[model samples]
Target: MRDCCLLFQGGTQLPSSCLRDEDVVALFEGRLPVSVNVLAHHHAARCAACRTLLVTLAHGDALPSDSVPLALLPLEQGRRCSRRPSVPDATWTPPAVLDGFRLERLLGRGGMGAVYLAQDARGDRRVALKVCVALQPDERALASFATEARAIARIQHPNVVTMERVGEVDGRPYLVYEYVDGKSLAELRPPLPWPRVLDIAVGLAAGLRAAHQCGVLHRDLKPGNAILEPDGTVKLIDFGLATFVGSGGTAPRGVREVVGTPRYMAPEIRMGESATARSDLYALGLLVFELCTGRLPPVRRGACAAFKPEAGRGPAALLTEWLPGIDPGFAAVIACCLAEDPSERFAQADVLCAVLEHVRRLVAFQRTSRVFPTPWMGAGFPPPKDEGILAGHNVF
Candidate 1:
């Protein structure tokens, strides 16, 4: 694939930022020099085009939306200005076969495109293929498509869905992913057993932490993005709205319009600010709250909808009113995640994972021994102040 960065330089297809198919093939085969291999991986970590090429060459598959209100359009829309076709989701017919993969059935579609369960005859595996069938290919749609493909490529964790290849059919952009066999958390009725909830919380936190460590921020984290496997694993998916943070850099300072689901949005995000790690956590907090209880967290309905963080109710109070029999400590951790102020939330996903791990240990211990333990029992009392969860104890 040609480098997008070079297109603006007199429309020349130069190898400025993107990797060539040959180099990617060598890199995938471990035939590149050590220095070049390191550099290629680093570039792939941040360059969507190169990453797409790398994944395509690695899996050996082939080659590689904007609209209403901008924000309400879909998380995949990039900030670039481009003319996009308005192909309604209901109007398109699924191609019988795309890039050697047979379309088995329609999974779902949104404002930007549709996803299908496809059969990869060569690989002998079922793959989830996402195509811009509804939007008709355009710059915005292409950018969003590559954005998700590149984002998932940077992250290598079992909890995150794996990207197999990137190719285009009939001038439309499409991505192939490992088809997950379980349902998303959004499909399950809530009020799950506390133990199960805690397990899901740990896995979800670990997954987010992996993404954060890779410098990829999932701006649109919600229950639907998390799929629960039969063995109780939560795999995080959908990075179309994800943002990559460069060294010593942050996400775009602001956005032209709000993105992500309004109910799952953080206050800052609703106000048109760039999403941060803390903001992602805020969305995660909402997700966990809904998982623990059967309903969503409290939100004010008005000109601007936002969470009631300062509302006169603590985590314990929430447990009493919304979810009884749940450990207040766990609730406190979720509250800390949903802090109204960005500075007040967990510093990063790993810190959140550390705390959740500790809570799981505490819960397991308490289940066997009914005896009231030490001061750690009240570690989550009141509310956590910043990294206060680790201030008094050695959580390492």
Candidate 2:
């Protein structure tokens, strides 16, 4: 067998012993770093068997793993391990096996990972690939990746950003998802139109319903992860902090502790308790609050907005003003979704769906009533004033 030439940029080399047969096995099974092009080059030059393994890793055509998301992994090893890899060179080119996936550019990164815009060469489709940081090869990061993949994989909804595949090349985990060519709600300038925002919320609620049906919980739901596609689709992405319930087992050992984004996290998660369906609902409600009022939910010491009709009313009154055309029952439903207590929120997605349908009807009713001029008209033709759902149609 030819000796493998392990290429280490900046003179960093993995001891030959570190690249053991067991490590290779783990690599083939989606448990190794998938982003180390240099390592792949080295392994290919030395071992024909490992070269073949490189092809497999590059193609990423393997079956999906039964493993849970990496968030659920044991973080102790990650915290204690000192095996961080050097960051890739800016001009590095990945091996040929990754040929089909054209990595066009880099996207913004988060605490756990970075995102890239890539294309599916096979289908001429675009995708967003999220690669976790390889620093230290922490077990906790691995578990988070695995957990996200497993939870999102179970959900199939048009409004949800779907997880297409999961791959691990060297020692790092990567997630492949359908590329969304729209800005996140948080990134939109001047905010979104009221109708558009409501549409997004409806679409998001629909996806959440599907997730709940599949026994999955989106522990962290926020505008930052809500994608608005060019074609007007609202997609909920980033399940990194989500949890899978009734998975026919207990919560993964590492994930049992509190995990989720702070701003959108439910009180229970903040309290270090296990997340439930209602927890997800609470997050969604918080998201709705942000979308409707251009602000966050009432935090400590903040006065709750009054339900008054004014140009710059707080979220409560704003919703009351624009939502008058909606049935009172549906308004109550939205209120219930925003309940302070998780238990008081809508427990099931179906209930929210019913409320949304009613709101849609009200929107239509209000529109028709304006166009046809009613018999109850009082005097001379009055100047047309913005009313109903259309009142806030020009959202940024």
Best by lDDT: 1
Per-residue accuracy of model 2 over 1-396 as CA lDDT, tens digit each: 012234344557654444533243334434456544457455455444345444534442121121111222222323211122224322223333343577778775654566889888888788888877655556666877888899888888998888888887556788899888898877875334555555676788888888888877776677677888888788888877666667531234444354554456555554445667766766776677566556653343111211222333433444566544333333344455555555555657766665565555555566677653331133122221221111111220
> How well does candidate 2 score on lDDT at residue 255?
44
Instruction: Specify the highest-TM-score model's number.
Output: 1
TM-scores, each model vs. reference: 0.73, 0.62
**Model 1 alpha-carbon miss at residue 198, Å:** 1.5
The superposed Cα distance between candidate 2 and the true structure at residue 39, in angstroms, equals 46
After superposition, which runs of candidate 1 have C-alpha atoms over 4 Å from their true positions? 1-87, 300-304, 309-312, 374-396
What's the distance in Å from true for residue 59, model 1? 35
For candidate 1, write residues 213-241 as lDDT tens digits.
89898877877788999999899988887
Candidate RMSDs in Å, in order, are 15.9, 15.8
Per-residue lDDT value at 382 in model 2: 25
